[model samples]
Target chain A: MRVLALESATRTGSLALVDYVGAPLGAPLNGVRQAAPLREITLDASLQHSEKLMPALIEMLGAEFKIETIDLFAVDHGPGSFTGLRVGMALMKGFAFASRASEASGKPLIGVSSLEALAMNGSGLVVPMIDAHRGQVYTAVYEVGAALRDRRKSLWDGRPKLIEPEQAIEPEKWLKYLVEKYGSVPRLEDNQIHARNVAFLAALEFGRGAAATRPGACHRHAPTLFSMTPRYLRAGV
Target chain B: MFILGIETSCDETAAAVLTDQPLRILSNVIASQNEVHEPYGGIVPELASRRHMEKILPVIQEALDKAQIKLSDLEGIAVTVMPGLVGSLLVGLQVAKGMAATLGIPFVGVSHLEGHLQAPLLEHPEVSYPFMALLVSGGHTLLYHVKEFAKYELIGGTRDDAAGEAFDKVAKILGLGYPGGPLIDKLAHQGNPKAIKFPKGKIKDHPFDFSFSGLKTAVANYVKKIEGGITPSLLADLCASFQETVVDDLIGKTVLAAKEKGIKTIIVSGGVACNSRLRAKLPEAFFPSPLLCTDNAAMIAAVGYHSLKKGKTSPWSLNAMANQDVRFC
Candidate 1:
């Protein structure tokens, strides 16, 4: 089973594949996690993509990794880059749905939060923040308890707000939100989250059955790609 | 099944086949109309579009045969629809749609620019997203932060004529004929790039935006002053001077963009991307594979693979997008 994952919501994005030795990924075969091997490329604005993604997949399948057997696909729904979100999600949904249809009716597909995954493997309180423009950021807070098997994913009850430097709450808001929402308390003071940390959380959640129960997690079928929208925290501010 | 991709965005009429289980390209055929347009200095879209319709079907047939596949074996169809000449784009889109409809399969409309960006990996197979790309074509000049596969940010773009357009215009002014880049490039090697004190429009602080109009006009005015007594050596000098300015502007903005964003990889593409000067002067810090240039359906088809891998399929309404219709300038 070949499990290919795509995360394209940040400046330094990542792609991973979980290779299981079988007809498809997750079908009771030996498996191992591998980063989808990416060749270094010079990127420019007008260098249109229509050819970018599929070739790499083809290369993988042809030489070493076979794709017809990709049993599970993991995609990162973003709190990072907006265009990446639309492009990546559109592609992810398409692939997942295709895989799900071809599956033997028992397999499930899913969407993973890029930020959450980036925060998962962290050593301390994971405060994942993605630049949200206009001096704002898309951020989430998470804190672990000792190590894996005892970790937690924090939630917020209120609407995700865009706070400026002046309106920003003290770092304690992470703990405050956790306490108010999940009623769990954090033990850390200042801990910054990185991408790998987010990826780790995503992996853990998928492993522990904490995420999407179906492929093409999006409930909507039609996604527009030609529009460029500015994702901001403050609405009509 | 065989998937034939037809692309005639500018000077190139390209056809490629996506075949078999892994969707590997069997035959990638591109018949560049650069020479035909070179005498005109710049591609006249009307002529280009007309030529595309004339040669498109043959190119398709050639690709199908080269791939050792037949139309009967083709399951679906794909064509580049947008961000290019409406006239040129229609030729490919119409052909693909016609073929698909006739064959009773789904038609996938691809963005032409996406085709260029996705070209290199057809053979190399290692290129992926989270990189930067500079698409420099006769009709377009822009910078994109390829934040992910098939996802692009319009970080910077040409405010006026694209790099290739400027090359053609400058080449014509110097009496070097049309499709000016190769001519200018060859002439540049014969003359000194520093011969003319041409200006490189430094939109200092614009970050990624570029403007080559001023330089193009400067070279034209220089030629006008010569009053038709254009010397061969002088033309070479002028071509070198103009080419130098264009290359500087392109490389400067691209390198600066990569540096500012801390992006490590940068790929320069498009017909103008095939320019020798740009191929030489583009700062090596960003682009390591300097030859990963040129406009081909191979890239578009490769990009198609990434889009599919990322799961980016289009509905029937997704038409070929024009440059004006694209998200960013």
Candidate 2:
């Protein structure tokens, strides 16, 4: 079974294809970091996501991997870029909808939380930090749940929060936030944007048969998408 | 004819199956992700879109299954494709489009806000045209002069931050919690709304295009001053106070607008519409069904049915939109 995954939660968008055979993707796919159970499609942090996302996906679907043979689909739900999420979700929904339109068997869409995806990159104390404007950040702390044979386990320990830049008690606070919050903190290595983690969570969910499932919501079953904006829960939307 | 409907304008992932000629909901399954969003205090678009993706198929399945209908059992699929979160919007649009094509059923897109505007019909059934409609939600707060099913005259709306957004931000600043509307609604039940007279901004007889940003900031500054720290009761009082002002303005403007337009029927919906306080305070001149006050897929389906009957089906290539100022006609 081939798995088509899309990650638009962050500035560096990613798409990965995984197959039961082996590596789910091939070269000619730009932004592709690692290949295999996880193939990362990286992009410029500043480039237009709409411009390159489809072309790369078509390549992966047509030449790199056979999308027709996929059994399920996966995508990221955000704690990342607002515009990116919209673009990515729209595309994923389009592609998935197209598949269903052809009288093909419907593939349940898998949604992995972006925060959880960031946590999957194997850090003992992983902080999946997304930049919220001002001197604040959206963060969820995690303890590695399980480690991949080749990669690291992306997991978190507690609920996410929108805290002042100074509130990040972890390491260097990305340094950028350090000076804004405190006088000066030693610079720590910037975390390489692990875009593939989005697909990994989807693959992980598929491994556990968690596709097309609903996450618990307060107040009468959460009422669908109208109540799902994480930022709405933050100090402000 | 039986119809399936999909609504993904903002945050709620909704699917409702209903009848066309006579509007009636068969199965309405809405999958909400409020808690996943609770911690952050505001919707993370990425999170919301992901939740939509996860819930879209199941919501459709449940709606269809509840109605005891398969894809082929339906005659048409109606979806909302306008005026919403582009990402969240796409999930519902693409899903509905796909279903229509697969089921060999025609599908059409409905305006997300217009769905709420028409919600009064589901309850009143006899609501006449040329009525006054005030739509309040997290994404929008507007006053419209409704002359017919498809004709609306823009009268007033918030200059900054929708009424619902104001409630959410105020509630959060007061540490009320994730969704401020309902919490504020609950707390307002105990507090004296008249205790604090929050500002009801008037644009000098403009009669339309309301302003809540001033009120929102007013409450924020007031709360910061009174307790010197955000507290529950203070938050509750702020909610009550702010709610009253909004209600006063909404009801006042709506009543006057109704009188001027020679129509009588004030309808409300959106996340903020779910507020019980406003529901009780909206006055008898408006829609009374509390259920009709909140956003739901039934309204979307109803609007979609109207579109279908009018042969206003969107081409399969139709794109999801994010702007509220949409002109489908």
TM-scores, all candidates, are 0.53, 0.62
Q: Give residue A163's lDDT in candidate 1 (0 to 100).
A: 23
Worst 10 residues of 2 chain A by lDDT: A23-32
What's the DockQ of model 1? 0.01
Candidate that scores best on lDDT? 2
Count backbone overlaps in model 1.
64
Off by over 4 Å in 2: A1-237, B227-236, B286-292, B326-329
Q: Please tell me which predicted candidate would have the highest DockQ against the true structure.
A: 2
Runs of candidate 1 exceeding 4 Å displacement = A1-237, B19-24, B32-50, B102-104, B226-228, B283-294, B317-321
lDDT, each prediction: 0.57, 0.64
CAPRI quality level assigned to candidate 1 from its DockQ score: incorrect
lDDT of 2 by residue, A1-237 (tens): 456777766667677776534423211111232336545566553525544565566555554443446555666766566556656665565445445533434554556666666655544445556665566555554544333222431322122222332122233456555467555443214433444455555544444332224221112322232223323224324
